[model samples]
Target: MQVIATAGHVDHGKSTLVRALTGMEPDRWAEERRRGMTIDLGFAWTTLGAETVAFVDVPGHERFVTNMLAGIGPVPAAMIVVAADEGWMPQSAEHLAALDALGVRHGLLVVTRADLEDPSAATELAQAEIEQTSLGRIEAVAVSAVTGRGLPELRGALARLVAGLPPGQPGPVRLWVDRSFTIKGSGTVVTGTLAAGALRTGDELDLTGVAKPVRVRGLQSLGRSVGEVHAPARVAVNLRGVDKDTITRGAALLTPGRFLLSDLVDVRVHGDPVAGLPATLTLHLGSAAVPVRVRPLGADTARLRLGRALPLRIGDRALLRDPGRHHVAGGVTVLDVVPPGLTRRGAAAARALVLEQLDGVPDVAGELRRRKLIRGSELARTGVDTATFPAPVAGEWLADPAHWAVLQDRLRDEVERHAKENPLEPGAPVEALRHRLGLPDRALVEALVRAPLVTRGGRVSAGGPAVPGDLIRAVETAFEGLGPFAAPEANRLAELGLGPRQLGAAVRAGLVVQLAAGVVLRAGAPEQAVRRLAGLPQPFTLSEARQALDTSRRVAVPLLGLLDSTGVTQRGDDDRRTVVRG
Candidate 1:
């Protein structure tokens, strides 16, 4: 589907032309029909070849120009209907200026009411005026709804006009509502040009300025019910859980979490910001026109504080108008959706330096670099797709990849330094490591350390001097000669120069066994005991275990206790134990 909004002087036959094209009435209110003018927006659609093109008829009266802006702001394509008799009037220029400020370039210059006067001159005049604006030279089609002159040609041109337009914007869903109301049985319904992206039935979307999200009960595109609707087309959404009174023009229906919402935005204007802006202004973007306060940072850049939070993307162009002073001040190109507060000294200058780094589109990489580390949710709200985003140090904390690599190296060096300096103490505590890296997240510290720098018991250190090569050789040789159940005597261990520290180290390193004091046994003694006991009985006593393993009570008691501690056995009430053979 395609949508085009009408722009021209009052009573220039914009609505009349729409009726002639669609064969449907464009006026929805009695006052509008009686007054012979569009007081608010009206909608109509007609089939142009294989496509259905929806027409948004906007009023041309200067008194309701803001209402006119609301109707046309979201429609990508337009039809500027100029009455041949009134040729190129004030509203014609103002409407064109609004479109120009919004950067709308795809449209047709239509000369309506050709029966009253020759349209060639009017067409030429309107075309020349448009040439001076962002909508450069566009061919004009002369037509009369009264005489049906050039109606067929106008229809073809409208189709071709939409065809020549650039492909629709690609992004998540954003529908700027122009009209919202309630129906007897259908609940709340809001109509707008689905400006970008798509939505489906039952999809929950965040409505800017409203805290609660609304769900799509049903969807209609170009006035037909559908399960889903894509953008750049007229959409009437049947919404659930929200009242009609709560919705208004400028409210945005967005795919939740994809777009940033804020009351303040930093922008780069087309001209000098200080000279081109008023203290109080109206900001018009998408389908919204809201009052705002501007703070100029430079000739081209400034910050805007809207009446309420609105969703805007980087590089979005908006019209800034001083209602009491000037109609169109300048076009504002958004540079940052999340601007910093200027409460501190030199904050303005510091902010300007940050703004200077931004390019036309958002500099996500540069932003991550500047912050060093930021919450993943913050970046998500920036609408930067994380699937295509660069990898971070850990989940939910974004960091510059190179910076994170540097952090890893720094962490390793610190751990190595701590261990070399304090070999007796378990490396440095996690808290110290967290502080050294200047990281607020403790989990990042835990993820950075591994291997030679070991982590255990609320501390980190290099693994115990690699188990002493000489002790490894001595213990392995002695353990090979020990009996399955019988133990190594303390005198024998001392003879081999294995002191208490050496034996304890061997036990911790999984090389030797110490069941109790003077009851050191073979390394695989527990495994041998479990197997022999599992075959002995349903439950076995310490006497039976010692008899089965042919080991003494001194070794047997602690070995059973070790088995129980390791869950190899479960002790019953009568002091007997059973093998937990899994």
Candidate 2:
């Protein structure tokens, strides 16, 4: 299914075109019907060339620009309706800029009420205005919804546009509802475009902005009940346990943990004609518009504090408006939600937020793959996909491929460093490694260890393939230095710097003893004790062993016992005599 929004100036005949194409009225409110203006969003659908298109008719007046933004927030394509009589108007330009800012790429231009004026003149003017926008090569259709002059051509062009769009892949589901009302028999019904994934009847979803669970009791696509709905489709959902009053525009129905509710987010503002924007305004995301305090975070950056939390993600786009005049200030793509509060004067902190927001972003697959190994809350925080939308895990995030590779490299280095230092120890603790990675969770490390990249035992470390010769030599030198006399500790080995990684390399090459706690033998003392014990017939006392060392009872007694415990010597009947190996 294809979902499209209609945008332009008020009195541009947007509602008229929708009514003509869909055979249904978009304006449902009594006041709006009486005033003949769309104060909020209206929904309708029509079949053009066998393809069904859902229409979101948004208000075009300057006072209701917030309403318009809510309508088009999740639309993948749109119809920029322009009145043929009054070519380009204020709301028309703002609507176009909003679309570009929100990243709506697939759409067409409709010059409406063509019969009331010269079709050629209006078409030329509208085309000229659009040429300056990101809407490159927008197919302009001149139509008289009353005369039906160009309806057939308009239908064909729209069909082609809808057919060319790629189907949304299954991932976390995001539905931005533009219209909500109670059907007499049904409890509550809300309509919007499904941004990603599909929803089925009986499936449980969440109201992100409201923090409530909504059950899908029924579903509709293009005005008819359907078993399932996929991405880019205009859908109406009959919700259980939610009232019409509870759900407002801009509230999103998402798979829980796939998105976060945040009031503070990082945004980049396009240079607009308007200057000296107040530190606060209203922000429209999805179908909800909330008053927000906007403090410029940088030269072209700002931090928005919404009156209430709104459902948003890093890449979601939004439009800002001066609440009083309702004029478009600029557009913003959400960078971080639940950001640390800004005090309107901290320039460095604000700049850092902007830079982090602008940092490298990775593809969805890589992120999901990374999430597979993260913990539940971390997964949710990252807003990675849940099961239905190709989200293979819950409570984790997916890293882009590049990020995942870098993370793997770091893990490998950490493991090698650990193995060298504690030759007696197995590997680094997994929990410690997770903390070092600073990820929301440790599941990614656990998951990656199972791959060809590395092996995880009692701890995690470099695995697979073989060690190099140079590292082997380094390990052998360190191990031989310890000889049969000493067991090394962590900090002491790190000072040498070539311990674990090099030692593991030597062990892998079969050149090092890699002694366990039980296997260590002190060289000079033990050999002398063993020689003295060989001449004795019974187990020698600690004093006897100490006396044999010719130094003190302190060093000799423990040293003899260590050799005995290591199986190189044995205690005799009295425990005071010792027997050495034959």
Which numbered prediction scores highest in lDDT against the true structure?
1
Q: RMSD of model 2, in Å?
A: 10.4
Which whole-number lDDT from 0 to 100 does residue 3 have in model 1? 86
lDDT measured at residue 152 in model 1 versus the true structure, 0 to 100: 86
- TM-scores of the models, in the order given: 0.77, 0.64
> Which lDDT values do the candidates have, in the order given?
0.82, 0.71
Q: Across residues 484-547, which tens digit of lDDT does each residue of candidate 1 receive?
A: 8877777878887777777776776567688876567656768877888899886888899889
lDDT of 1: 0.82
RMSD of each: 6.2, 10.4
Q: Tens-digit lDDT track for model 2 on 53-96?
A: 88889999988877788788877888999888898888898898
Which regions of candidate 2 fall more than 4 Å away from where they truly are? 209-212, 273-276, 338-582
Question: Candidate 2, which ten residues in sequence have the lowest lDDT sum?
Answer: 516-525
Error of 1 at 297 (Å): 1.7
Residue 321 in model 1: lDDT: 77
